[model samples]
Target: MSDFTQRFLFDDFDARGELVTLEGSYRHVLAKHPYPEPVAQLLGELLGAAALLIGTVKFDGLLVLQARSTGAVPLLMVECSSAGELRGIARYHAEQIGDAQSLGELMPNGDLAITIDPANGQRYQGIVALDGANLADCLSTYFATSEQLPTRFWLFADGQRACGLLLQQLPVDRQKDPEARAASWEHVVTLADTLTAEELLSLDSETLLYRLYHEEAVRLFEPRALQFRCSCSRERSARALVSLGREDADQLLAEQGGTVVIDCQFCNQRYPFDAADIAQLFAGGGVEPASDTRH
Candidate 1:
């Protein structure tokens, strides 16, 4: 399968933007979970949003977008790193779902949360009450309230494809080209809003840009590929077992017949630890597991 793709740009004036569309990669992530239509769509949107944000930010860090509800869909978490790696998982109360058709109907009081884990700086978090009728509205509200920038976002996804657009207002020197900046931002967003879901899902970066901004003078950079990658492993699980204390680990191992197994909810990958694995993990004593070192 091809990697997920991200396209980025800055207006000749002061604003910046990104357009990201994912099909095969997004479908691969969603395939692990048998989510309802609304939940599945939400997961795809979150994945697109996370990829876009990761493309925009500068860090060897992780950007996570999460939506939680006490309603039918209990939890949805999407993680994207600076390198364009993506993974997501969703949990739901199947009994409560009861044939719900949309996010609003399924999660009456959902909340959206954004977390930025920078490699060097302190972790940051932003939370917003799910105000909009959909995930896009909720995230737009988040940007307006939390970032306080004149930002606009459009996100749409079906069970098969996910797409998103992000426009952010960059602070300009108040005296120079302010009019040009405002005009450019509005002009670009206007064109972007006219985009159809099919256009977003099917077109390549260059074609999509031309379709939207052919008349205008816009700079398009080389597109970066995004990928569906699960950051889970046996070593990480064993470390988690060590954190559970020897007695607790022993109890679980005893109940499970000398092995404790953890299934990654995101990728449906299993990490199992037998007795020797536990002994090795304990012998290492405080050595953290390598989450990035995948087998």
Candidate 2:
């Protein structure tokens, strides 16, 4: 019911913030996959984090956050486009996932990788070894080493819900003293770090800010809407089949009743393409094949 995202700016400080409450979006993501409890919780948090990260970006791009593990949860990936659409999926061993408590326990020696692809420019990537016990710290490392920006994050996800808060420092005017900018950024991060997961997901923007920054003059911005959306289609699937080469595609088509069945791992949407679909793909060229976005 209360499924929306809000972006707020601190009026008197050189700082901005974002808060996301996920209900319908979270449910829609989970409905497609029967993930284990631990994996599900991690996916929810990653999904929220991805949305928060993408919303702040100015250009039309895709923002991806991934957790790679050598343990039960081999890999967890979440993607958010510039339009505020999101999709995610996880891979894990069910037996190993049993009785797992924390994300660290499930993803030992894990790391976080973030990639940004602008619509008209080249993509960029940053990676950091998993150093903290939770997603927040992992992301903290990213901000410190990758962007060098003073940033803070609060992430929380139970078996049912997921939410996050982000605060970042903004550049100051040339006439403004450098010390003033540093101090403002430091103060914002300190207050933001004091936020708890319960407070982040449960309280409204006004109440949460009052609790954290009661002493500072804070300005809140209009909220943004975030939801679950899958970018999948029949033509996309057919193009993918064409990439498999004609011989392989025909053999598979012969074995499977002349149809290729493709399912979207992110949303579980199924696309069925018969021989005729394959013929059209090769005949009418120019449609690019669906490439893997996870790399």
Candidate 3:
């Protein structure tokens, strides 16, 4: 499949891994706005990492990867849901972002945030300083420090598509001996380190797996499909308007020249409401406002 995530288990290494290859979803996010190459690639890698992170957890809500800075790029965010919906956006200053390639350069003094908001449980978040050379290094450090797990991530993106592969050493393993388990982990991680961005981005999932670990026994699970689906709707935007109450809504409406407009940053979809529509929405009988507008 073109856009999917696959989970696998290592028979001998006692470790598990995840691979995600994104095309349609990545292109759809890019189509929403004009992004420079560095910003676009950064968003893609975040999308890949978000997808892999979703697969690693058992949650019914959303997982977000975000980095905000006062430097060149103000905001870089990507999110994926339990149902495999993916969306991302990046806001950057073109003049300040010239020729800067590293994450540190793109976002100085930035904080990388991984947020897990579950539908029925309390939300959890991990924050780290974005001082690494690349996004992958930052994520690897995050996992090492936070989860205390030996997780290695390989993320890549071209203007066309984005891809990511994650190799994690499962906490509980078949190898009982400590030294042998460490050795196994090292062997698998060492082989995984040989993976290049080209091979990870171009090759198919099974082909790439075989090429990387043809000698090892690996079990590939069913792939989960992912798509670019925006959660914005007229109804939801109307509820937001409801919260503004009548007076504020009227003032905002006047400022907006008649209709109140709310734009979805992820998909750039517009939801507009006029006077009558706002009155109906506040009257407890919601009315159809207007069709969505995309720029």
Candidate 4:
């Protein structure tokens, strides 16, 4: 009812659109870290984009949006699961964050990667230069350069709530005439481009869609609910300890006062690995049968 993604079809044209709004989930991700205003807003945009991806891409597993850079913001990542779970994080250099406004300014020379890890199929990845004026334009550039669909994204976030609208041109379907398809696509995107960030962040899916495409034939589909859920768990943490090998695990356990704490950066959930737990993990016991402890 609150955090949701909806897909709509332009009944008269060969195009479709995705709408996503986030409030509770966005706040949850923001609460996990002391992210600066810019970083938080950027992360919110990524989260919105990730949810929109879920609506547009028919995948059964996980989809990740990552932008890596060596500038003020070293990393910005968002994960969306088919089951409607979402999580995101951002790492930034404190000294350089105050003046950076745009994505390029915050993460100069960054590469945006879209990774699809299906539950049963091969993983797919697409990388593009993050050089557009905004996140939406950046994604629009990616879709345009990749020769996929003619897709344009309108992403907005104010560190409190995040929302986005994505309009993509599909292959010749209902509107068989190439010229008609082009005209329809142009009309839809032009109307969408008239949208403001405030309107996007404030309006509901139905109102916004009507405001933009009221004259066009559009069918709004039922929205899929989304929530903030970290994939980290005690078992996953134990596996990380096992990867360190016995000697290193033991050394870490000693360094952390007999308990090696592995914190989930996305959610700040802590997993403590004591000596016995580490021993059992390294002894091939599998996850070390014990109660879970997290903060």
Residues 125-194, candidate 3: write the lDDT tens digits: 9997888878888899899898667888889999898999888887765888889889998988888889
Candidate 3, residue 168: lDDT: 86
Q: By lDDT, who's the top model here?
A: 4
lDDT of 1 by residue, 232-267 (tens): 976677768888988888888889996677888878
Residue ranges of candidate 2 with Cα displaced over 4 Å: 174-181, 285-295
For model 1 the local lDDT of residue 35 reads 79
Prediction-by-prediction clash tally: 1, 2, 0, 0
Q: What is the C-alpha lDDT of each candidate?
A: 0.77, 0.79, 0.89, 0.89
- Candidate 2 is scored at a TM of 0.89
Instruction: Report how far residue 46 has shifted in candidate 4, in Å.
Output: 0.5
Off by over 4 Å in 1: 8-12, 173-180, 285-295
- Collision pairs in model 3: none
Candidate 4 residues 16-124, lDDT tens each? 9999999999999998889889999999999999999887788799999999998999999999999999999999999998778888889888989999999999999
State the displacement of the C-alpha of residue 212, model 3, in Å, after optimal TM-score superposition: 1.3
Worst 10 residues of 4 by lDDT: 286-295
Instruction: Tell me how far the alpha carbon of residue 198 in candidate 4 is from the true structure, in angstroms, after superposition.
Output: 1.1
Give the range of the ten consecutive residues with the poorest summed lDDT in model 3. Answer: 286-295
Q: Which pairs clash in the backbone of model 4? A: none
**Residue 271 lDDT (model 2):** 75
TM-score of each: 0.87, 0.89, 0.96, 0.95
